[model samples]
Target: MHDIAKVTLQNEMDLILAHKRSMRLAELAGLSLSAQTTFATAVSEVARTCLESGKVSYLILCVNTDQRDKFIVACLKNEQLNSNRSREGLEHAKKLVNKYNIFTSGTETAIELFYYIAPHFRVDLEKINEWRQLFRNEPSISPYEELKRKNEQLQDLSEKIQKSEAHYKTLTNSLPLTIFSLDVEGKLLYANEWLERYTGHTIDYLNNSQWKTIIHEEEYATFAVLLNKVITQGTATIKTQARLKNKQGDYIWHQVSLSPFRNEQGDLQYWIGFIVDIHAQKVVEETLKDNIELKNTQAKLKENQRTLEKYVDELNRSNLELQQFAFVASHDLQEPVRKLLFYSDYMVSNYSGVIDEKGLGFLSSMRSASHRMRNLIQDLLLFSQINKERLNFTDVNLNEIAQEACQDLEIAIEEKKAVINMSGFPVIAGDASMLRQLFENIIANAIKYSRPTQAPVVDITCKQNAGFVEIAFKDNGIGFDEKYIPQMFRLFQRLHDRTAVEGTGLGLAICRKIVEMHHGTIWANGQEGEGATFFVSLPLNTPGN
Candidate 1:
């Protein structure tokens, strides 16, 4: 576009021709008619001044052949043009084109008029040359036409400004936020309806410095600090949270964003900002924080519970080991006690004549004590071993076990003249060896606690109910009070004296232990000087059930 052409402005005729040439060139370069007229008039005035001053001047018209950045430049250039530069004429041309600039070198002056052509428009050098020739010989207009064009341009600009303001107001009002603008003096010159309605404040509050009253007292210092930053540092964008009093006089949480606008000279002229209600969002945030804290607490509690469970498990295991050791140690002690009884019996038999009668009586007492001590130790061992040993469960016919127990007690039965009556029974899941021992102990106990006149009649009966087999052993015995039922299964809990029973009290306790090991129950019912019935319930399934 810097390519230049010149025409001598020798007189009004030449000036007019140069102006027409500039007009036609601008038109061919795709300028609108108004732009062409405004630019051409300025050229005419400048060229006329040059001709009247008797200077060798020319009108320089340029056309850029580059399509991407195309321009058609018109200028009045040369040292003599400076003396005839129509200042008022150039000032009026400002509204006509995109913009213009003046350049001077030494004594030379060039008023460069920048006229735009569409970037994609193909440059037609041939058409441009033809138009240049045609307008070179064309006529010019008077000052009346120029004045009319200027007035029309001014009127159009005023209408555009009014429309722009209306559009801006409509856009800000349509938004859901509270939009406002602040001037350099921290005065609110404009605030949208949303801002005024939501805050219950207007421009009057800003003028009287009462705007701070709408902000929560707790946030006044914070808002003041931020406003100071906007005033001093000229920060373009800022955001902060504050509680603003609403129209109902209730404080609502809001997030305020501000952006400062600057003029062409890069001085801050206005601060455009808006307030967004964030009360609900803040509440949700707080709720989420509490939930997180609660979950963490629950997790910690679960961890503590797990640690406690492990500790309890360890304690149970240690107790079991100690019980097993006691059983083993008691079993080892039984061997010595057995030998002691055997040696005492031998001395009493062989040395009865060798020693005196008193010596024999003392030997008899020693043997009785040793026998009692051995029985006590054996009962203790059995009780401790009950929980110490692993149980292997299998189907056991309690009837068969009861029959075998009766056979084992054949001597005691005949000696006591006991009549054992056993009916048919059910098979159940349990440790077979333990069930055999349980039947033996319960039947033996029935025979042991019997009245001498009754001849110790024992009746073993069973019934199947639910998932268990209930077996009851009834005896015509000298039964104890029913109030002592709970203590009847406890070790060393004897209702009859040792001199009458001639047996340890651990027998019933061992029976209860065996029943419990099979996941079953044992109990007794009785009346004084009447009879006692011991019941055993064994599960039909595994203990886990």
Candidate 2:
């Protein structure tokens, strides 16, 4: 099952929207007009029940397929209800849909309705995509309808506020912070009890004096400027810090924020403001500014720096030993394989008279296996050695790199009759040997994977981007699906079979390591049977050069 559309049922209007969307999707899925209405009505009934529970619910329309049938599925869930609070509504909706099921797990309840598509009607990814686009491009509600929706929402909000007005006042009076509201004309409308007790001023006195008796004189000037700007512009919310005189006659630091409240038509209605004491935070800041405390912090930071450096040194030493062991192990393991290849050749040349064809073939297979093992070990050693610490940067010309790579693959290019086109090479700072290897591996793969019926063609192009140079190697070969791109660059991750193409599967992996060492990137693009292009982007100014 795949969800194509989702709507949150927050109010009555959302239920209406859900119903409309359900009918549209059903029609798009090749349902009759009557069937569309029936399915849509069923979904809306369940959605209404969930919304009436006084919590937000979700309705997701999905396309699900089984072996023999395709279904348009609607899943409506409400997490606040554990039991079936609308059992009758569910039964009614169930009768309208072709199939229905209700699932309950702990506090969540989900109802799934399925409308099976007729066998003659077609449903596929392309059709599903069309349905999604249609939903996004659906025409907006008419102006009259929109106005009615807004009016309904406003009425609901008004009723809620009226019912909760007493509780709201009690909650604000018990809170430690100050809450206040102002009219559009900047007149003081109301202030909570906390503000009055903290400042030892009544609401009437605050209104007459404009709170000058409570606000510190030094900060009042800045506060007034910001407040007047908010009143005149009525733009975004603004927050500032000021010192307000308390009942004990101490000026304490407080954070004040003023936000303009707008009505449905986007007209500024009034302002809401809050003030919270932040005297303790200000004292902490002052303490941190002291020179002695700053020096102590610096001393601790230096100690941590030394500890981190010590650990880094130990890690580098361990890495060096591991790299050396890999080199030594690879060299040691190659000797026996080399000897086996030599003895096999010797037996084929000197003992041919005593051996049967089957025995000769066995020796041939042993020699082949030995050679592959030798190549694998060599590739592994190269892959392990290409790292940032070992990189030696220089002013290298990429044209030379391309030429060298082509020279290395001269035999394969000639065998495949490959045409190599190169142009727009640039000079950049990079490791010479590694860059050459990068070009060689990619170019070699281009030739090796060429279509058998056609001669191979490899195009090498370069472009200079901001602070970097991008080089692309495009090949007319038997390419791969772009999805296999990530897999192809991983060590021992190959898209082609060993019998079809011969390599250790570490070529692209090594290329990536070399690119990363130069603070660069490598990627490729291709389609099956169409060919592929591999891009390597290197920085013009190499890091640590």
Candidate 3:
């Protein structure tokens, strides 16, 4: 930490200051002027990268004595590690001086330079001050050297840009759609190979403003007006259909889309557009239009009516068989599991003297597994029944439904010392039994997953938006990650381990299906260890509407 100079990259001006400070530190380490210049250039480049990334950077110079020998070091640290190019630049600079080291701690990257100190040199205070002043007052590089360096850098940059452009050109040419770029005034700046090939024109022939001649005469005026509007307003409304002249000597239907790209200041830079040929789709659409009055065609209706009836009959038969199978399967599956659980419990109770602790534990595990299996089957049966049952919809009072659910869960609420909160509710068009089931299951889960040794709090809220009533159930329990919200309402998708939280993972799915049947929606949001909120939106309008 001794003999150190530090500066942070705050703005454009700080970049040069950082370089000059590093140069002074290098000169104080008894390096030649060439070494100092190399050090300054490397630092300036690193600073420029930090500035472009809009991150903070710190430059420091210090003395290190922990190595085999004492040395002077310059370190540049930022939130990110030195990029490959930056490291390469520093490596080349090291050839003109001593060694360089790179270290990373988490997200922070540090580059340290250990300078080659002259054998007999000790840090002279006056010399250090003079070098610092020189770096502070004058340019870090001589005019001639700087001019040569800038020219070399410019040449290398130009070559890289050209290589990148060629790579992109190859990619765009391989796509089937036409890709082109336009300036602010609607003049074409570049076009991919597909565009040139489809139009049967060379880049020079239909280049710039000349490309407009290839547009279909009927669509030219409208297309031109839209292009001008998009460029002026910077809007996505430039997406529309157009007829374009192709190499086949015919005008083909194409879907043209213009996406505006902007600079850092949010000002429009240019428009990147794609023209995709959709002539086949357009033809199919035209055919569909001719038969728009489907029911009026008596011959077509008679032909389709018989086929549709047969399909509907088969679907009804399949649904009936599926529901019957579910009922039979759940009953059959529960028997074996129930027997195992019963026998295990009986043996544990009657033969405790003959059974060891390990044997009892195994019996306990069997009981748990049997119970879990029974729950899963029951949940599956309930879900299938809800789908199969065509229940009547009525104007059900949600407040009454919520109260009934709470009453059903009174035992659990009392055990968990839970408090349920709800002021008022809405009367919405929905199936009463399904809505009651939804609230009961959600409320039961809230009490079941409450924080250990803490009283649980559940809040129910209802709101109206236009013709929809949104009911939300929020709980102060061990909530799950919001990232898994999509999976939350999916059958057999569990976020927590069964050992910790027992669930068949069908409650939310049932709720979603019920809401969807009523032409509404359901969703849940939560964060781990915080709480969860489940929303069920149902329409206020009746089913007949």
Find the candidate with the highest lDDT and give its number: 2
Taking the tens digit of each residue's C-alpha lDDT, what string does model 2 give over 1-545?
87888777887778888898899888877889999999999998888888888876889999887547788899999986443756767877899987987788888888999987774656777877887887666664766445654665688799999879878888899888999987766566788888888998887787678778778888887777544635456467878899999989999999998888888998888789889999999998998889897889899999999999999999999888868867775878788988998998899889988999999889888988988888888888888888777788889999998999999999999999999999968889989999999999999989988999999999999999888999898998988998888798899998988888888898999989889888899999998899999999999877754
Provide the clashing-pair count of each candidate structure.
0, 0, 0
Candidate 3, 244-315: lDDT as tens digits: 888888889999888888889988888898899989999878867867564467678887898899999999
User: For candidate 2, which ten residues in a row score worst on lDDT?
Assistant: 225-234
lDDT of 1 by residue, 1-545 (tens): 54444565666666666776677777766778887887787667666655665656667788766656666777776565544246655666655666677888877667777667773455676656665565444433656435433554577788999999999999999999988877766667788889878867678775586468788888877776555644546566878888988888999999988788888999888888888999999987877888978789889999999999999999999887868767665767788888989999888878888988888888888898898888888777766767626677777777777788888999999999899998988777777777777888888888888887779988998887888888888988988798888888888988878878777789889988888788788888988889989888888888676
Error of 2 at 274 (Å): 34
Q: Of the pair 2 and 3, which is ahead by TM-score?
A: 2
| Model 1 residue 290 distance off true place after TM-score fit, in angstroms | 10
- Give the Å shift of residue 81 in candidate 1: 99
All candidates in order of TM-score, best leading = 2, 1, 3
Candidate whose TM-score is highest: 2
Estimate TM-scores for all models.
0.44, 0.45, 0.43
